[model samples]
Target: MSDSEKKALSGLTLDQLVEFATESGLPAFRGKQLHSWIYAKYARTFDEMTDLSLEVRELLKSKATIQLLKLAHLEVSRDGTRKYLFELPDGKFVESVLMSFDDRPSLSACVSSQVGCAVGCTFCATGFLGFKRNLSPQEIVDQVMSVQRESGQRISNIVYMGQGEPLLNVDNVVHSIRTLMASVGIGARHITVSTSGIIAGIRALSREGLQITLALSLHAPDDATRDVIVPINKKFSVAELIDATHEYYEATGRRITVEYVLLAGVTDSPEQARELAELVRNLHCNVNLIPYNPTRAEDGVVTYARPSLDAQHRFRKIAESTGKTVTIRLERGTDINAACGQLHNSYVAGP
Candidate 1:
């Protein structure tokens, strides 16, 4: 079999790895060692598994392969945020971001679920690139592994907020989440999955019993405004999406996160902020306000500007007046086009 045809060992669970090992005529302990090396030690190549005998290594190498994403390009912002562009085995590209904070010792990684996005959120650069294939569980998990190896820091938080709408690839995403928790040792609470209000996917995720945080990218409060920016909102609507979030909270008991992007004139008005506050007043959630990050203006793409600091503060104050927990997201990696809604794979021409 070709290398591509070989089993990818990086995404397998402990039991599955043991099955692979025992099926290959090796002892099950070898599978446990493989799990530790691939998920914990972040091994990239089979030869790095030095604990295995040479014969066993060669046999495993011939039968299975460790498929880690190849780092294509990297950018470091002044704020110590690092953005990585990875080239997949098929030559497609995906982006991952590692963010470090002055107050916290642990790092956070934002990983992509698809090569490009289909949601087509007007403010998101990734959506403008159009849709590509969904990334496998291996591809998704490997992003965290690669970032951890490159930064040499423990990634305590993982966000599925890069490149694509995570719920679009819910199966692979859930698989990767389990792999991250079981093999990589990241807890469910530290991992967050953001969606542009995919209602069915939200319902499915709530039934999974995983206590990971769910963030709805409800960029606008009303259906009319949401339909214009987040096209998916047309199908799901603002009220329906809010209802799904409430159902999710009831099932998971984990408070939801409502992600709102403050576009200069479009979404930052005081009235809209008040409307947003009232919209979610009864929901068990906190609001996260993201300042728009400007993308390169192509001919057909609509241009948007970030809200001024004063405008942002006014919106926050209005939302806070209703006794809602609201916070303006601290911007990161804007200098390198690596901030929120800025992962467009600009390193290459287009998707």
Candidate 2:
């Protein structure tokens, strides 16, 4: 099929695929077969649907195409974390990280939801690039399928913690989550959608009635520090964000995760930790402490220092003292530039 003529079959829901099949003069069951092949079996082409007859396969080949992401580059770190640069059809690039665990052989895929990012957090690499475009549901789901196929391992956890603010593209993200849960068979609890404090998105997701986890990137405790680091805080203050988080818990009954990125001398002070403890004291939530990832200094771009071990522990101690569950996230994939806040595909392209 010609590139311009063929339709993308990857984004279609099962019911839509059924409509496609029925419209093609085939039995409705062919939709289930096609869905199973594309999502469950990870078929890259129409020919891979061996259960379908040659006639149906040829018909599909003429009208539809199952397109996977074109792998532009793959970086594997010494710590066994892998970063993938996938070239979209429009020549834009997005990155995803595959993290491997030692205790269990499970793998987690951190997928991107946008080309760059509109949330211009001073220290984030993607934020430096600015927003490009929101990925379609197919683009989002393809990240997981690409990681699983390339890594030769099943992804047990899916984190929407990559390039862009997930809630900014809430509809596509939620659609991809449904596909991941219903079609791909990953449990709802295993999927997490992380947003940089989009109150409407959080409230919208809470109404979806799925058991998926909601992680809010609460990088600072007070509005002043947060406004500097997380610019979204300027619009929605810490108190308003917390109120929305509480509403999410009340509606969904799922414990929210408050993610804090520790930056040296900026947000890691003992006093800030106390403020953070007070900020989240009333919310039913867990705190995930992430160390700031360094990036090359560029003009007009803000750089931050990674917190020292003592500072990290001290902050964790203070946050934990508030009787809320808190844990420090072990940094991974930094060597490969795939750790938290390090994904910038513009620099990875060949000269």
Best by lDDT: 1
For every model shown, what is its TM-score relative to the native structure? 0.94, 0.94
RMSD of each: 2.0, 1.9
Candidate 2 CA-lDDT value? 0.85
lDDT of 2 at 259: 95
Candidate 1 structure quality by residue, lDDT tens digits, 1-351: 788778877767899899999999999999899999987887877889888889999999889888657788888999999999888888898999999888888889999999878888887777777898999988999898888878877899999998888899999999999999988899999999999999999999999999999999999988888999999887998999999999999999999999999999999999999899899999999999999878777513578988889999999999877788999988788789685435444567653
lDDT of 2 by residue, 1-351 (tens): 576567777756788889988998889999999888877777887887888889889999888877657788788989899998888878788999999877767788999999888889898878877899999998998888888767767888999999899999999999999988877778988988999999999989989998988998999998889999899888889899999999989988889999999999999999999999998998999999998877766523587899999999999999988899999997787777765445453345321
Error of 2 at 127 (Å): 0.7
Off by over 4 Å in 2: 340-343, 346-351
Global lDDT of each candidate: 0.87, 0.85
